[model samples]
Target: MKQPLRLHTPRLILRDFQREDSEAVLAYQSKPAYLEHYERPAPTREEARAFVDMLCRWAEEQPRAKYQLAITLDGGQVMGTCGVRKAAPGDTVAEYGCELDPACWKHGYALEASRHLLTWSFETLGVRKLFALTRPQNLSAIRLAEALGFHRVEDGRYELTCP
Candidate 1:
């Protein structure tokens, strides 16, 4: 699906990641707690640069298989990254994920960002279903998914269908 250059909400501006966003991304990613959640080891500084480059490249592609946005405030402070992607070819179910800076946790930003994302995926992308996978112990993610109208589909997996 083609993505707009940016999306706005009452309190957030979702935009493509900028070159300057690397520092903020790196800062949050450096947190040991956050790093543990990723499948791979924590990125080195050089690797982080490459990762950001990949994010920007994906954001620039039209009809992309995946799109990620840098979640920011209206004032332009970077919060984290949130995105949706085709789970598999012609699967009808897209995968969603979000990460918020530790400093910005508990502010409801993840939910707000997710609401916009799900709307865009369902309406703009013509998606009918969305899903998320998280560690079973991640209560906050589970709550956020439930708050956004997802139901437990399986162990550590949740699904949300369009209304």
Candidate 2:
């Protein structure tokens, strides 16, 4: 499988994870506000390194398939991650998720990253549909999903598919 490599948007670059990203990942994940509703908060540096290593492994194994990308601004500031992963056998779809720095919120970064991944999933990976699960209290994410053309499917689930 060819690795899922870097993609560029107008103001951002979505690329594969790098070991160097550990510190930035920690900076956002460590924030109490960021983890308030997340089940897993930021990990220690060692754990973060492991997590990033996992991302690199996934990218290499699946290529244009299941992948986790590091979202960075043009200037190389690591913002967060976005990705698509294959769903269960009976599902015939893919799951998507993202996390971004709070300091970068409300600037359309999430939408840009998501759009890029969704396009890759459909056009590159041939995924038929995409789904996302977010906490009910995370209204911002819910709204962003809606704005990106995902329809609410349940309390904390949303979905989108290629036409």
- Cα lDDT of all candidates, in order? 0.83, 0.83
- Residues 1-163 of candidate 2 have per-residue lDDT tens digits of 5645889899999998888888889888888878876888568999888888888877776223467899999949688999888843334488888889988888999999988888877887778888899999998889888987899988899999885
lDDT of 2: 0.83
Worst 10 residues of 2 by lDDT: 58-67
> Which candidate has the top score in TM-score?
2
Question: What's the distance in Å from true for residue 115, model 2?
Answer: 1.1
How would you encode candidate 1's per-residue C-alpha lDDT over 20-91 as one tens digit per residue?
Answer: 788888888888777666667767888778878898877766546676888999847788989888854345
Error of 2 at 127 (Å): 1.1
- Segments in model 2 whose C-alpha atoms lie over 4 Å from true places: 1-4, 62-64, 87-92
Off by over 4 Å in 1: 1-4, 36-41, 87-91
Question: What TM-score, computed on C-alpha atoms, does each candidate reach?
Answer: 0.88, 0.90
Error of 2 at 116 (Å): 1.7
